[model samples]
Target: MVLKIGDARSMYRKFKPHLLMVLIQLGYTFLNFITEASFNEGLNPYVYITYRHAVSGFVMLPFAYFLERRIRPKLTWPLFVELFILSLLGVGFTLNAYFASLRYTSPTVVASMVNVISSLTFIIAIPLGMEKLDLKNPRGMAKVIGTLASLAGVTLMTLYKGKSFRSIWSAPIHMGSSSIHENWLKGSILGVASCITWSMWYVMQAYTLERYPAQLSLTTWMSLIGGAQSAVFTVCVEHKPAAWIIGFNIKLWSILYGGIVCSGLIIFIQLWCTKEKGPVFVTMFNPLSTIMVAILAYFVLGEGLYMGSILGGIIIIIGLYLVLWGKENDEEEVPMRSS
Candidate 1:
């Protein structure tokens, strides 16, 4: 009887992290849908990002001072340097690249390319020593197969290239701005570059978590620093007084929602999930975000979902499950403790 009980305990232990991971993915899905709705409405993506970070930074400050400061890990020079780099990679460069891409490509293209992160994470994980690849194992085979399947899905979605304004997919299609077509190819390249940069950010976060281990605290500090940096950059690049001004009540509320709910809270959840279940696990679940965004965009942006997006999303979902199953198989079973 004791042995049976012990075995049951061990099984539960094995599944615990995976359970937490699913919950985190669900939370992110919710946030992604809301944020997508928010962004589709006239808000400039960079301006949106800047405000989100600023609010997140503000929200994090008191919490860090009161809760984390006393027990905060000592900051060595190397860690400080890494902290700065992380802010740059995860927040600054990634957001800039993402917005730049959005300026040129359709959201569908942007969403499809995000699938690249799973493959990118698997590749980048090797050099960082964050994850090991067992080239000979069934698990390894699954991961590779899954990654390729996802890439194929992206190709199908992008290459099919439905007409801009007259699609059967959604509502009255606005093929974005008229200027987009003039530079659509360049925008597509930039969008993919954004995906690569964002993938690197995920890997960096995983690497940093190993050293910092304090999820909320680290995100808070990074947000503070990143906010300042981005704000300054926006001032130089946009140089539009109207964009910077926080005048109307609606604008104030929007900034607060973006910053606190989307940025600060969402980031805390992301770190917790990644740390618990591993980075690839979290990345694999990101397709849920795309699905959520699709639904929200339909209602909010009146952007209809085409058969292509549906088929592509379904393919991406299949690929995600493949990768996750591969990861699960890769995990070794360990003995568990008594209650």
Candidate 2:
């Protein structure tokens, strides 16, 4: 069957956000392994965040300047202030807490924590009036129920390790630690805190994107501001010069990848996606990343594939389905800009 140009364009545009989010999840899933490895190699979390923001901001500056030079809005005082707060919430404080959590916890645990971001975001978005969760509406029920199911599944996945599976990995690359119980408690607290900040970031980013429609420029400005904020904090606290050093090692690579791909590109893509599909829509995919990480751990690191994992995966998928149903009911309404 021959397809018309207009039809193909429509199909591409329709599916683009889904494809983009899948790629984002894959990037983050692999990043979990890489960042954890770098942490193990003694890369300090605060220093890592400082460098990460610096790299992303500097790297994306040129692209934003070139592509958005004409369309970028004037940096008004209110807008500047809002963006500054966003930089603080989204980048500086958020990432510092996140990497610190990652330093204490394994990637799988971190990924599991990510499952709650959607629920938290949904709750926040509702009070902000971004989401209309009328229990009367079937759509609202779908979202609410989906979020609860996903959260339950994540709890089960993390808490219940039913059985041990044989090693599917060929190489003996030992990375995970079993004696992380104490650290896990600490990391879980940090992870939950990061999720809360991250959820706030999502809701705030959606609101900010309205007045500042230029995604690339917005990302660049936020990165620069956030990077500066982190750098200042790191300078005050991190006294050792050696901790700040960027040697030819995993530290350098983690900063580059986390900065360029995860931060720069991913943030821009997320901003674009959040613009297209509301903040809650963007966060609903966090569970997918958790599932990917679990599967990867089994095959790559020889981690056990437990019954809870499989059952949790099924529940998570069903939750995603319900959320997708809810998304269909969401009215695509951008917030009116306030004067």
For all predictions, the C-alpha RMSD in Å is 4.9, 3.2
Q: Candidate 2: worst 10 consecutive residues by lDDT?
A: 330-339
Candidate 1 Cα outliers beyond 4 Å, as residue runs: 1-44, 161-183, 249-253, 299-302, 333-339
lDDT of 1 by residue, 1-339 (tens): 999999999998876656655565455554443434344444555676788787898888788767776667888999988988888877777776665565566555566667677778778886777665776988777787877777776666656635433334554433233343246777678767767877787888877888888777888878877777777777777866666655555446667765786567767777877787677776776565566556556655566556665676678778877777777765543222221
Deviation from native of the Cα of residue 15 in model 2, angstroms: 2.2
Q: Which of the numbered candidates is closest to the native, going by highest lDDT?
A: 2
Give RMSD (Å) of candidate 2 vs. truth: 3.2
Model 1 weakest lDDT span, ten residues long: 330-339
* TM-score of every candidate relative to the true structure: 0.79, 0.93
Q: Which parts of model 2 are misplaced by more than 4 Å?
A: 4-8, 172-182, 331-339
- Residue 103 miss distance in model 2 (angstroms): 0.9
